[model samples]
Target: MSPPPAESGYSLVWSDDFSGAAGSLPNQSKWNIVSSGPNSGNQEVQHYTQSNSNSSLSGSGMLHITPQHNNGQWTSARLECKSSFQCPAGHRLLLQAELRSGTFPANQQSGIWPAFWALGNDIRNGNNVSWPQCGEWDIFENAHGADFSLGTLHYGRGGTDHLSKGSARQTFQVESFHTWAVKVNRSPSNWQDETLEWWLDGNKFFQVKGSDVGDGELWGRVAHKGFFPILNVAVGSNFPGGGQPDDKTTTGLGSGLQVKYVAAYKSN
Candidate 1:
């Protein structure tokens, strides 16, 4: 493996530099564009598109996941790195990304939600494991037009009965570039002994352990398993606004998430 990046103490494991020419799609072997329009249980308004117009690479070394109102319908993109990367237990898993978003007018920011997160890899490939049960680790999430970012963990028997913890907020706007990251460490012998730390712009904010979560058993299962990365821009969820977003609420032209780079590392 290559040496660890000087800034991070872990050895680099996987990364997407988004170095393709402008208008190019992400490497097919590394990412899978989710093409489903299921309610997603989030009441999100945007229909995820598989087209490069919604998710593409730029000559500026960035990945753009833009949401647009096309033909009176809202569309966006979601990319998952299920087939390429996985963070297993007993290792310190680190994920970092530099990102920014377009400006939102007034209270309209509540209409946009962009996130960098991860979920248990078993949820896919016919494992038949459902969400919440499979676990979710939100490394970064910006809601509405709030001047802060949030990091959270979700795991439980079901969505409604889900248990979660780890809400560390950093004061920052979506229009400006920022570095967001999270490091997860699970004990080699005891899954229950796990720690998750959150960081923004290189400042460590909060840390939580498996015991910190509401349910010890549920959170323990999540700590023991492997997870994969997901990048998406959602519109009008319960987080940003109570209802679905429409033409007036959504960003007309300059709205989307711009990711400069995404990288994962493992402790030596």
Candidate 2:
């Protein structure tokens, strides 16, 4: 079935419309399945897979990506479009998505990490020598905290050298769905100044003043290039602290992340 007519006053620039192809991916034209854990900095223990079994649209506008426990390890699906479908650079853009925690949820602190975000459009070709410098926009990231999620920006240097522009906590009722958004723009000097915000059931909750893109030069320079979107659910990582340090692999509810759909709009 086709998507409902685009909402009045809002043009549908891009959408996954989960109303079609339940149990199957929409199309390569919309999303490129990412199959690896190398770019996943969270130290998550799940191998990203690209198959209908791992990611599919279920009827009623819901997409399910259950991380499965197989071969003595955990594996799930991750999707990206680094070079394939780069978002127009230097334009104010919004990355939004409706996501739900899996059926057999994994909230083991050290387990169940799901996120909706974007990266520099040139990351696939090795253009991003340093993150955040290359640019990253995390719209919504949940760490299994009773009903709270996190929004953050990591750039300049990786790990300890990394500088976070801002971060916030919001209580999330995962049993239901919510809309998460990240608005980004750059200054004349090419520094990427961004704003992070979100809501549960259309109720405002999380917001933070994003990092200043052009304020400093200690870590080279920052640009206002827009990045493509990334949707994934990982096992565990040092970033979303709360998990057991000893548990290095993904366990608990095998099924990983579930996404209803994703969209983006240019801020006029």
Candidate 3:
């Protein structure tokens, strides 16, 4: 499938349409299969896996991150982009994706959570700077099989505690594809004045300026620093649900996270 067109003054920087033979793994050079404990450990019960059974190409230009339940364990998939992207000085950066919430009904999706988000590259590259300080930007997140989604920004002075800004809750077609995006604007004359905006299906729902953070230094670390993308389905945690997969939750594709594409654009 063709990638979505960039904004009039922007050009494509990187993208993946997930076009390939069905069941194949994602392109290795473009993504790293994360095999870990619930990705940052959110009290989630699923362990991300490297198996195609968990994450694979749909052969129809889509990527599927499915979660499976076994004899007594739950397993899922998580992928991190191999590159870090940022809004260049005097320009802007757009991170977007086309996603659908599987085909399952919200009520039966107990513990199901899917998201498209990013974390500061410092943490990805093991730069030694810990979380919160490194920053986190959540472009889209749906939990507990809810009918709505959320967007958020996380940053602070460097510790377990952090400051966060969340977008207004918005509902969308539960099982249909929709565009989710976040744009980082760096056109401000001053580095401390950059901003981040969140959009859902072309509608701007939230915007936050660096000044809103109150700490110029903290804002710079989140707004100006390079960040990489992440796609994963976690099964319950401190997230909204606060519950794990129950008997009501179905396993397999019906509860998976489907993505048509993931792309980044830089304003010309």
The estimated TM-scores of all candidates read: 0.87, 0.75, 0.96
2 against 3, candidate with superior TM-score: 3
Ranking by TM-score: 3, 1, 2
lDDT of 2: 0.57
Candidate lDDT (C-alpha), each = 0.74, 0.57, 0.87
RMSD of each: 3.1, 4.6, 1.4
Model 1: per-residue Cα lDDT over 1-268, one tens digit each: 2222445557878887888888999777888898977365787768888898889987778888888776767788899985434446667877888888657663655567778988887687577878888888898887666677778888888657777776746677656888888877864556556787888887888777766774666765566567788899887676633456644565542567888888888777
> Where does model 2 exceed 4 Å of error?
1-10, 37-41, 82-92, 103-110, 125-128, 157-161, 185-223, 244-255
Model 3: per-residue Cα lDDT over 1-268, one tens digit each: 7467667788999999999999999998999999987644677889899999999998888899999999888999999999999777899999999988767876678888889999999885767878898999999898877878888999987777788998878788887799999999999898657889999988899988988887878888888889999999888756764577788899987888999999999998
Q: In candidate 3, which residue pairs get closer than 3 Å at backbone N, Cα or C atoms, i.e. clash?
A: none
Instruction: Assess the local accuracy of residue 118 in candidate 1 as a C-alpha lDDT between 0 and 100.
Output: 86
lDDT of 3 at 90: 90
- Which prediction has the highest TM-score against the true structure? 3
